[model samples]
Target: MSRRHLAMLTATVLAAASLTACGSGDEPGDGGKTLTYWASNQGASLEADKEILQPELDKFEQQTGIKVNVEVVPWSDLLNRLLAAATTGQGPDVVNIGNTWSASLQATGALVEFDDATLDKVGGKDRFVPAALAAAGAPDKPPAAVPLYSLAYALYYNKQSFADAGITAPPTTWEEMAEAGRKLTGDGKWGLAVEGANPSENAHHAFTFAQQYGGEWFDAAGKPTFDTPQNVAAVKRYVDLMAVDKIVNPSNAEYAQNQSVSDFANGKAAMLLWQAAGANLKSQNMAADAYGVAPVPFLANPPAGGKQVNSMVAGINIAVFKHTKNLDGALEFVKFMTSDTEQVTLNKTYGSLPAVGTVAADPAFAADEQKVLAQTLATTAAPLPQVPEESTFETLVGTAIKELFADAASGRPVTEDSVREKLTRAQQQMR
Candidate 1:
């Protein structure tokens, strides 16, 4: 899922409460001809997503005589809304979910499990990408959802900024990236833009950094190991980008709503670490040729246990609520959405890679940006720990990072001790 739509901690807690209250309910009548869908906001704006999706819904309606009433839910309210629906059994028949929430939501037992027999209704298990499928739910359990759109993080750099800085190529190592950032940071322009205040964004970077630092957020039992030495070092390293390195603008410490993306689009920043940023850039009027894409940088010198991973498996998944009266219509809609034709069409418009394997060779996804993201997703990306507590982990740990960013932006020293303190508090809360 894009960082742009990650829900806040409070909303997640409320949703979690609602999920605990979920129970089997009597099915309501829908006449078996209509389905309600709650889609994530994937475009530049809510209206933009509706404009892009309504046509496809209409196409499905024409083909199957089943109408889809779609609502583009903002990330802030999506999880809460879904949880309420799960508790009351009165929500949309079909919904889009952040892939990381698969295990957490699946634990509610309110979703229809896509076992082999159930999957046969929608193309079959072989039709999807393996990595994407793996993220749909916990291992050894039938997935609660199927991959809809695929994404991975990449480094987006301003081509002109690099040329002006006399840089010949994009950085492949973190040290090189910092060096380049130094050169790019002058004359009112900053080296990079980061969404410092966004907990979801912070957690995503934290996960990647922890992997590169030979750390894990959870142990073998799925318990949080957040305040470990490796994790402390990882969190400190990220906040130091502003507090110590001085490469990022201090003002960015409060950027939770994609102001960093705006900065990159307007050339106020030279680089961005983001997932599938092309469509968003285009929406901001940044030309296709204005920037270049490359795999996210890794450590110049990794520790003993450090992995080569650079990104987390990130994307959206589609699921059917078990309480839906129109189960057949809902399954048909899932089939329609994940079909190869729709995969190419929708993924292309959203600047995401197709989740279905059959569309991997489609010419629409042959662009440079897509290639970089595809390579990362296939090679270096690892999914977040697929535990039932994954959503709470995101909230607690992500908010910890957010608070640390606040300290950095406010001119406070960001030491390993401070990082450890924040992480320790988060872990304590999880208990």
Candidate 2:
């Protein structure tokens, strides 16, 4: 998200577009030919994803008379691979991208911008959840992608642990969460698990916490506000779980989201803040009845300025490449992927929610965890900031939190002064 990284990405996309456009003789029409797709791995493995999605692609091909080639890309390599294709002008016709990267990727002009006419081809903006749609691209710009899948964070608590601790229900506010943590901490288990080592995970929780404290990461003009008093307080509250409250393990400074979630599933921790982790828990042999889901905690008594907004719309989007030789086929493929039947089948395999509002009416989504998260995405979630530098914001803020955790783990002093000092440095670096 650094300007340097942005510059590098732009250069890669532009250079690739130019070279491919000049080097290749194929015009911008598929003429009812084959289409290549780069799908993010949504199942246990690449082969597993193929097993789940190839049938759907086969359906699309049979119905549309277009042969489809899919390459399942892992999460770690998707962006870099896309960048390489962008730079070389050899990327797939369609791709899946993290929604947070939509605006950033759009700025490169290597993606097909979905105008009103094209949007109608995919059932229009009205078909999708407004929040998820908003995240497909910047507000002022035509979207380069459409919402394909959706997710939102919620508190996942161990039901048995809560009952043993004499807690009747999941905590609805920060005060109660802390109290619950205290009660749940005495049996060789911590009350909460945190992804202190994962920048993206930490940055997301920071966003929710900052909003609850009535703080904004950016001004209307998109200036960094990382050092605001409310933001400082929110961050201090997060670190205190380890430093002051002693409810989180001090060594959690090295724990990523997967590790934290694993701890929660294995009963090493009583609570976890996660998004749609039901499948992973099931994989770990945690029974469906062993856990309960609730809204992420917010301030019980939000100070005069605080608000109760709880989550950010978190998920992936479907995008088409502008340089594809088969533009029409690519468009058709996008439509097929977003269709009601495909949406349900695909999201079911991914353990995520459908991006389309009407596509979510199935009773399967009414189960406890899915229902709570779907409700949160509909009622309380906000999109991450749409500015071009949003990724930069994540890296800076997430790194600062990681540093704070390291201080706690090392038994160093963690005062407000230290928090302000680190945050101020991050703000200055953004300039």
Candidate 3:
């Protein structure tokens, strides 16, 4: 999942953090028999992730005689924590990172570069899915990490709610979606649920909308272009769901903690735009059959430069830190986790697509939801810009949109001018 970004870490802070580094002394003193790991919270909760991973970790220990000390990190703190560890060289031997942040983290030069030799130590570079591996780092460079789980966003709608509202089928275009959403709204139920307060979630949608509107957040030279007319229109179009279309609940302005998913599962909302939401819904006691998945809608009339993109290529990556003393053990662990058997096991449990190609034909991934995600990933989803400043772009633009959502919820007008002004401020901050 995409995570909240704390303020950008200044170079001064990084230098200061580096001054206290003790040169690989953070490794366990047990002769590399033990390794520290920081895992992103992938399950319903941090504890839930530990429960799911402990057995797999134990299996690795049995096979390799190396014990992993794992700590599940929440999305809210993961980025900042990672930055501290990256600068100080004093944390996990291995870590899980949001795939979009791969390039940004790589800029610190704290991650082990997966060159041909290093990749050979694990599995060959060909083991991962091409699209997934493409997002692991900047283009034309050795990946800073390897793909672990793959995801693409889809529109999930309550089947019963659609039927009750007399809607015949899922929307194929933005206009149809808004019309459907209007019909779905009434009787204390909203047409759509959104994680408006969440910066990362907001950024993901912004990227997709900007794509459909023929907008580019970054120019050809990889500079911020956040306040262009196309982008302003795109941002306005999204906030209008609450501000103008009135299909989303105003209370969604405060939903940053997956509360939008809960609202959808509980029938308080009819639709959700999310990445691999099935596992999360099931955890909320929602049955598999309760919802139908469809491709996220596109513009009915796209502009001249519009792209067919619908979702951002979303997933997690596993990276080994340069400071790791147990390089052999860490590579072994990576190989074990990405092995075909483990890929199927973990992806099935998380409702995510396997990052490796060998598991594509597995029966465990043949579900309807999986099919939709697979199709999207194979066809239309684009990765967020894999530039060194991508994470900072996510933070600045996402927080700006979050503030716009807050305004919309507070009964303030969300106009094109207001949207442009907010985006301009975000662009200025990037400079």
Candidate 2 lDDT over residue span 170-275, tens digit each: 9998889999998999768999988788777777888888888898889999888999998888888888888788778776889854678788988989999987
In order of appearance, the predictions have TM-scores of: 0.93, 0.87, 0.94
| Candidate 1 per-residue C-alpha lDDT over 227-336 given as tens digits, one digit per residue, 9 for 90 to 100 | 99989988888888888877899888888756888899999999999988888899999999999999999999999999999999999999999988778888999999
Q: Rate the local accuracy (lDDT) of all candidates.
A: 0.87, 0.81, 0.88
Model 3: lDDT of residue 113: 91
Report the Cα lDDT for residue 344, model 1. Answer: 90
List the candidate 2 regions with Cα displacement exceeding 4 Å: 1-5, 8-36, 41-51, 65-90
Report the C-alpha lDDT of model 3 over 199-255, residue by residue, as the tens digit. 888888999999999998998788889999989998898999899999999999988
* Count of clashing pairs, candidate 3: 0
Per-residue error for 228 in candidate 2, Å, reads 1.2
Clashes of each: 1, 1, 0
380 Cα displacement, candidate 2 (Å): 1.8
Residue 200 in model 2: lDDT: 72
Candidate ordering by TM-score (highest first): 3, 1, 2
The residue-level lDDT of candidate 3 at 241 comes to 89
lDDT ranking, best first? 3, 1, 2
CA RMSD of each candidate after superposition: 4.2, 3.9, 3.3
